[model samples]
Target: MHGPVSAAWLLVALCAATGAYCLLRMRSGVEEQRLSAGGEALMGFGMAVMAVPTAVFTPPRWAWPLYAAVFGAAALRTLWAVRAAPRHLHHLVGASAMVYMALAMAVAPPGPHHAHGGIGVPLLTGVLLAYFAGYVLLAGARLVPAAGSASGGGSTAAAGIRAGAAGWGDRPELARACRLSMGIGMVTMLLTM
Candidate 1:
């Protein structure tokens, strides 16, 4: 978050809004949805906080380590949850990335812009950027309607559409889109770092 203040605030808004939506998604009757949404909400809010511009309010010296600790615990939780839901592995990666970012920020020099210096390993950031870039592409693809679908006059497809349109919490496509947005945001943050 060493960029312009406006960009930082924009990221904050995007992440906070996504976090709010994920909170609503937690109300879904599906247990898996609830679990995933909870984890996503955590990520969204955490990213928002981390994205805050340094000029606005720099966190205490201890805060970075706290962030690392919290995200490290989140990574562990996601690791355990992955046993029940394999998809939680993505959450694990997200949490681990957060931990990495936190540690990087912690070691960064204090100044007008917390220059990354050599604290953030270029290779690791490159790996994370590549991973999230691929994830964004894949999640975005999942949100797009498939070509040649028999939805022109198909009653089943129509009913399925109607069902998916019922509530935001139950819509798989929106959820995928949300994840895509987060992946993009992660890529942006990593680039700034």
Candidate 2:
């Protein structure tokens, strides 16, 4: 595999791991937790399929339409869920991006000419880059205090964690991390394209 392909595979692995963790958390018998399990799994699998190295496997023409349909449905679901919580908007954006990528790939020329550039491509890349950069910076900032406290004393970290005591599904930090991971993956995919 080449550099971009290798990076995509690494992202696939991370997304899969995150999805697996979310699935495990869903087993806790919490209604709210269960609601997101499907979305997480879909996101993971969708990214994996999109990231597959073209050398290893180039999806057939029909597959692109299928992917577009699947991600379109996912986008709709995420939009519906946004009424429950604003955070679901991020998921909507992710699914929409997937749809965009799928459509782009569907119309792309075959062979080495598949990856091309234009004003639209650069615009999308810039927007995605800005969003992911902000997300990572904000999330990293929030984690800083936690890291500092944890470094000061292990018990302090434990105490902080215990006080929070949220179910894995409800963890803001983990959710942020997952979003960041997906953002990075999206950016990587876009750049390769």
Model 2 clash number? 0
Candidate 1 per-residue lDDT, tens place, 1-193, comes to 6788898899888888888899999999777788889989999999999999888888987999999999899899999999887978888999999999999888877776655564554888899999999998888877767665645756544576676744658777778877887888798899888
lDDT, residue 71, model 2? 94
Q: Which 10 consecutive positions of candidate 1 have the poorest summed lDDT?
A: 148-157
Give the clash total for candidate 1. 0
Candidate 1 — which pairs collide? none
- Candidate 2's error at 179, in angstroms? 2.4
For model 2, residues 1-193, the per-residue Cα lDDT tens digits are: 1136677678779877776766665665556666776687688778877787777787888998899999999999899899889867877877887888888788877664445454355567568667766766776677555545556546553665688765556665665566566666766766666
Best candidate, lDDT-wise?
1
